[model samples]
Target chain A: MPADVTALELAGLRKSYGGQAAVREVDLRLPRGALLTLLGPSGCGKSTLLRMIAGFVEPSGGDIRINGRSVLALRPERRPTAMVFQSYALFPHMTVFDNVAFGLRLRATPRVEIADKVRRALALVRMDAFEARFPSELSGGQQQRVALARCLVVEPEILLLDEPFGALDRHLREEMQVEMRKLQRQLGVTMVVVTHDQEEALVLSDYIAVMRAGAIEQFAEPIELFDRPTNRFVASFMGVSNLVDGIVERDGEVSFRFPGGARLPVVSDLPAGPATLALRPEAVRLCAPDDAACRLTGTVAFTSLVGSRMSCEIKVGETVVTALVPRHGSGPAIGERVGMALAAEQLQLFAR
Target chain B: MRGGAMPLLMLPMAVLMALFFGAFAVFGFVSFLQPASGMPGYQGPLGLSNYLRFLTDPAALAILGETIVFAIVVTLASILLGYPLAYIMARSPYRVVRSLLLGALVLTFLSGSINRAYGWLILLGRRGVVNDALLALGLVDRPVALVYNWTGVFIALLHFTLPYFALTVFGSIRSVPVQVEEAARDLGAGPLSTFFRITVPITVPAIISGAALVFSLAISAFAFPLLLGGGRVRLISNYIYDQLFVAFNLPFAAASSTIFLVVAIATLCAFFWLEGAVTRRRAAKRGAA
Candidate 1:
């Protein structure tokens, strides 16, 4: 079932170290059993925000609530949350069984009950027969699984993950991503993941919170955030986007121009004014020089083969515009003169 | 040639080793040839009498007991004091604090044995600053006699060994990855639990090595015990010194010194074995996982 519970809430949270603010005025609403990802570049406060939510960092101002109960004053151990770190911080001395049993042991749970719960948690992560193994004996992916199992054994109200797969190889990272999402769904526990990788966020998050210097840039559903970014940073950060500077003439007749002299027709209802425009590289198509409607002309400067697609950089105006063409029969050679037409709807204009 | 140079380097030490070995061998052979008979002079043929006399002597037994207790107490105290100082040194934010600690450590090694013992002697004496404060504060009615006893010797030993313990343990603590501690905290372990469960266990090898070194030094300590003990407490070193310098019984003293060497090696080997066992246990646990 979809989470009808409000799992966690942050109200105007702020944190500063010494005198410098690391996280400022951050507020969020996380649904119970939902996975929320905070995405941004390094030092953008995403990790800081996640740390605050996990209670590792005490917010200098504002409050946090878990399961509708205020947890602002609680210590990390007292808070009803657990964090999985990027380094897979499994205790090196303890066996997998003991590491998973640590939380239950801390709570003074019965030995038999602790054993049962650890066994079940390990099974959930599909790591059932590895109980006696120390963390050092496992591979990177196995260690990550052990870490996840350790966190889940606690059955906390929320699980906070700080780039849990950041240390894994690409293949293992992707596999863990799928496995983590499945586990989160199966157990119906809320999860908050922090990562700078936009693709990982898009793959795992129900809601993506894009953070910039000490503030949230935008927070919305993954599809909405990617398709309609609120600003240039989000647009460029989310994926490959071509930004063209231009001025709208009047009454939705928009013409987008690059740094050089080349211009392309764009669709916008913005009043006649200077503006910025954006288009995905895949949205533009290569055409013969004769087909000039809504077209920009330039010399094809460089070409790179990416899988089955070819990306060509065209010197349009004073800016280099890239277009990704499907590598079908034939395509333009480097230095070939080309005209690229942008689909009218694909070009988006905004006020500068 | 590399092989030729190897033998050249070994030759000097080898000759020295042979001479040292030859002296001990000759002493042993001579000790058996003539055994001590009356009030304490060799007069007869080879027998087990010399060995039996030394092992059964009450004074010899007391020295052995005192040496073991001293080694254990000094080793324990060094580890207790050094672990916290090492932790602080490894994590202190200010470079000046680290430099000050390092400066203090260097000062520990600055003075000769007599000078360092004298410093300890003054502080621990009944009329010294420590007892003066105790009486002035009414913590005691009279100045307590702390010097010229085992307590005085222990204080001196602790002073001599603490800096070495700190320096060695500091290197080990520094190598403990900060990420490990952060991971523990993130996993909901409190600060104290994380420290004991993670940081302390990982550095056990260093602690064992440091303890073994301190124990060896404490057992063999001569100047500190001789100066501070002031004829009250007799350690193995003092006993050996009296046997050699006062009694001039080279064979008996050699036998006692050889026993001390064997005990030291045994203590070191025991600690190394314990550390190896713990490591193997951890590795086996990982394999099971």
Candidate 2:
């Protein structure tokens, strides 16, 4: 695949609205054929950053490169990129055929070619039979499919989506997520999807860029991001994380000491100093008193019988921590004394 | 839903309609009675001679032609001029400015025709400010004749009808959400392409309605045409006026008035038919989709 050369590069992108910085000095790169997601909360700069790349928004300062060529000054159409809007801005007046063929028609492509390409794009999105339907006549998921078809038919070097499935119901959203990942992989198109949903990011991205207040906090593969988030922000934003205040002792081991005189030994190369220890809720286990590890003794604050798992909230001092246990297992009852132990390798220690 | 209100609401309006209809029926019957040549009152047998004369009159034919042509021209002019303005109004960034523009449009139509034409007369007449400016700028050697002609009539008609077209078009354009435009552009379309292919097509209903409104307004206009067209241009209304006032032929004039009324009513029916066609086509397209 020639290692799929860097398809897009953003160097210090910046944007502000009404003196409020929406995005600031953000930099990232996407490899060819890679599906990268900008994941963060609502107020985060994920969508703004995506807009800058899509040319709907101009960066206050920075350069955008595609295929090692500068494209910062290019208009949206001039640049070889297409965007799927969160609202699925399909042309309500146009038939599905025309909407999908819009870009080719703009380029003055031949009629027969446009028809062929539109059909192919529609097939890719599994909407081949809906070519004559207007956007308003379609369901939400169908509109989203047509939107995808429209962008795909353009055959752009990079495809961008801004929370494209945010309007879909949960089941449709999950289905579209799977459909999108499959289509992107099948076409080997370099794609960027902006989403606030962490699970959507996890499921759809090969690489996830966790954004925070106008900046890229961490960029890595999904597993890399989940396993080793460089900062507390990425770790906490990505999933349910239990953060413990701790101090690094000698060697590679660390100990988290709470106000209640409970000490937990953890694994980290972080130098001897005050730190915050983060571990995924799934990484901690409910253990018997004889089981040895970094244990925290607390009363079960709450318990929820989720479909496949029993989620128990354990209280350590005044801080409430959650642990997910297998559904059939015997778990601690609410208000019962319990001891939770963190696996050594699962603990993430960040220098405070 | 209110107490003792249903009958009260219907009674006053029903009485008024009955009175109005009764007067129309009486006058219309009187118009049909033949007049005696030597007598001071109607004495001849009831006949259709007056109606026959009205239908065959050359002057009536000319007035009808003038009315139709005037209506078509003004409607076309309004549509051509109002569309861009409406588009701009719809897309205006400032709500205050948009509201002010709409308010100005309302102001144009609120005043009587006599007032509006008088204002135009001062601006468009020879030796008026516009002509003075043109003369001073050396654009013309003499003051151009602008008032009391077809050109002046057209100007007044356009001014009256333009605001109507603008408001209707504005409503249509504003109803089309911006996301549709953004979607088109995001699909790799340039701004111009997005507008013509998407935004313009979506607002076709507005354009149709605006044209219809301007046409209806232009056809019935009496005050402006009478004031600005002078005697040289005799529309149906002016012809009817001349028959009743100058000719003093009440039967002939009433017959002519009835003919004109029928024609106006017919034209309005045709306009509605055309709207029906457009709406039906739109509905069919939506159903097909």
Interface RMSD of 1: 2.6
Docking class of 2: medium
Interface RMSD (C-alpha) of each candidate? 2.6, 2.5
Poorest lDDT segment (10 consecutive residues) of candidate 2 chain B: B35-44
Clashing pairs in 2: none
TM-score of 2: 0.91
lDDT of 2 at B274: 76
lDDT of 2 at A34: 93
- Per-residue lDDT over A153-196 for candidate 2, one digit per residue giving the tens place of the 0 to 100 score: 88889999989899999999999899888888888999999999
Once fitted onto the true fold, the runs of candidate 2 whose alpha carbons sit more than 4 angstroms away are A245-253, A271-274, A327-330, B1-31, B35-46, B94-100, B245-250, B279-289
| Candidate 1: share of reference interface contacts reproduced | 0.60
Local accuracy of candidate 2 as per-residue lDDT tens digits, B227-246: 88776666787877776667
Fnat per model, in the order shown: 0.60, 0.60
TM-score of decoy 1: 0.90
Cα misplacement distance, residue B277 of candidate 1 (Å) = 3.4
